[model samples]
Target: MDISAPSLRAVFTAVKTEFNAGRSTYTPTYTRIATVVPSTTSSEDYAWLGEFSRLREWIGDRHINKMALHSYSIKNKKFEATEGIPSEYIEDDTFGVLMAKFQDMGYAAATHPDELTYACLASGWNTLCYDGQNFFDTEHDVGEGENEKLVSNMQDGALAPWYLLDTRRPLKPLIFQKRKDYQLSAKTDAGNSDHVFMADEYLYGVDARVNAGFGFWQQAFGSKAELTEANFNSAIEKMMGLKSDKGRPLGINPDLLVVGPTNRSKAKALIEAMQKEGGASNTNYQAVEVMVVPWLD
Candidate 1:
């Protein structure tokens, strides 16, 4: 959990080398996978408002509100509202829809073999801001198209990027107490709190899938603690099945899997076990190409 600066740098170096070596000019696409719990009360609405308010308070009201409005407008264009509420307004909120839109546009491309697609899971805290006025009126107003271009710049030759939200759903209770608990635990015993480093509202909403993706890629690529070709191959095979399990063939196979350190460890163990089994069975199989990255704290 206490990843030193040197360790962080080393990881980045490895990531950059792998990414640049496999870098392609192909435009990277992405897929958005998300989960949401429906809101059932005004308190729920207030909860979202409060969370958004907290973000605004941290940066400034003008910035947070504007960004929210702008994001809403962009998404609203695609999702027409039926009455006073926008049709896209699921009880959960618009974040899910925005992510879905990105996926539909192919932003979240797969990282499979043959296709040689690079895949990544991106997450961050409240990196956007909006005012009561037009949401587009801020220094952060990169148009949707421009946002895509910015993300493309980060692909570094991978096929697609998968954006994951690892935060509380809008309208959900803000568990500040849970965050306090983590902080207290971290201060007391480093070994006692594995969840101490877990993200909280203060860090902004990041998706759990981002963690999963990080774990998935590290194991698939053999970039973590254990380095082995067999493990990598097994990881890739499992990913292939996940990508298209229902007999619907996705024309491409992921060449790369992007994941974080925590999930990477889990994925590594899973892949190693699978490989051992396959070796025992004496089956010839190719490993998967994967990349592991840590996007945020």
Candidate 2:
């Protein structure tokens, strides 16, 4: 194999091709539970998150919509994965494995959003949201003054957590904020790149600026209790009965149930089975789409 500039560039191109192909072949699951919000800055503010208003008759002056200036924010985060192949391997034509690894790198980058989104959700019991409370707390404040009340989106217990989401709205229960999409880059110039000169290896990497946060907490319910018919029904009822600050129904309908692998069988029986184990018709069969992800406990 030639060790010239053209040859090195060609190798980079080949690795990038494998990477792009791997990216295309990977399927992502985050979009079903989160909304993608393209970001233009290092961070974004959601202070205006709770300003949704209801229309009133215009007999008097017209009502105006307003946004709070600095209520909540999510800062974009940097992430990277790097791999290298020794010059000896490329020169000796033994870089086949490195090519496969590059393809896998692409697959990993594509799957990163799912990892982040679900991990953020799994940690929602502690992470604060626009309301200055945990995203899945049992006491999110609603309304104001005498009308103010404490509302809960979480059912607490010592069991594995499951989630119910109303994803039909314009904004899903989770937010995926991306400032830049993952991209492949290389330090392949053997003579020019300091890394190559020092290590005698060509480097390749994928990097992105992205982060995940909670969206409208009203659109999601998290329960750590045993997953049962009674509990599932309670979650559904709770979500459907949620309202906005002004006491208007938010029309939350739980259309997705997300569970970890530990709850796979129960989730299947709750939503995917046509009949119960005892021969009774399963009234909750297919009540919502179930996603048994491996990310949560």
Candidate 3:
């Protein structure tokens, strides 16, 4: 059978399909529950889920219940309240006039344009990067001593492979909360706790979750390596030839090469070199796309 090279879109689609499959199969600690029980205080306890399937051979209880801390800082080790920040006050001197005008014109702009914009796109970056997945399986989650290998590696200022998914496995390498909702005034302050006048204000809160689970995935330490054609090819080979927890060939066919800005040019050159017909470094000739992740830099 004659076969030409796959299109870039085809290759990317294949990679994304594998990614989605990995996500779909992911067994979060609370996958059995219809609604996650909010931990009044954060704790790593998913024991209520009972015995895990063979699919969860790599995951553990420690990977569950990662709290979505809107008012705390895990990295800085401090309480970072979302409210109490100074907001610019704009007195609508025309409120009375605006209402009268609305009655006549049938339209009145109550909120500012910038305010609406920020409200809509506040979590743009996180949503894009994580594919709209929540970090936690529980509600309003926060915790101490909960260890995530990815977050810990980042905290230690190290570069590690955050994930290596094997679709054949019964368990997914990653599990996201899949939460996507927001309330304009989810947080009620002292003045607005029980009942309040218009003067009492409320703060918006995101129905966000925390990310957990690292044992299900693989971690590679390669940030210290120099960016070169040899290194790039070697990394790909390493990924493709990975072994599972059971020590069998994982058969991981990596199709995307993600890099930081510092190595963008080098990555581009490597991609081009591999795509060039009859090129010395094009032995494998696997079509892998390159993506420069700005946040990685």
Candidate 1: 10-residue stretch with minimal lDDT: 176-185
lDDT of 1 by residue, 1-297 (tens): 234445334433433333333333233222222122222321111111211232224553465233222221101001111111121232233323333332222221222211211112232111111212211111212224433211010112122222112122222111111111000001112234333244211111111111111111101212222323454454345434422212232222443344555456544444334454445632322223223444311
Q: Per-prediction TM-score, please?
A: 0.20, 0.96, 0.39
lDDT for model 3 comes to 0.31
Q: Of 2 and 3, which scores higher on TM-score? A: 2
Between candidates 1 and 3, name the one with more favorable lDDT.
3
Arrange candidates by lDDT, highest first: which order? Answer: 2, 3, 1
**lDDT (Cα atoms) of all candidates against the true structure:** 0.25, 0.90, 0.31
The whole-model C-alpha lDDT of candidate 1 against the native structure comes to: 0.25
Residue 264 accuracy (lDDT) in model 1: 60
Q: List the residue pairs that clash in candidate 3.
A: 67-141, 67-142, 68-141, 135-209, 135-210, 135-211, 136-209, 136-210
Candidate 3 least-lDDT 10 residues: 72-81
Best by lDDT: 2
Name the lDDT value of residue 51 in candidate 3. Answer: 18
For residues 86-125, could you state the per-residue lDDT of candidate 2 as single tens digits? 9998898777777888889999998999999999999999
Question: Using TM-score as the measure, which candidate wins?
Answer: 2
Score candidate 2 by lDDT.
0.90
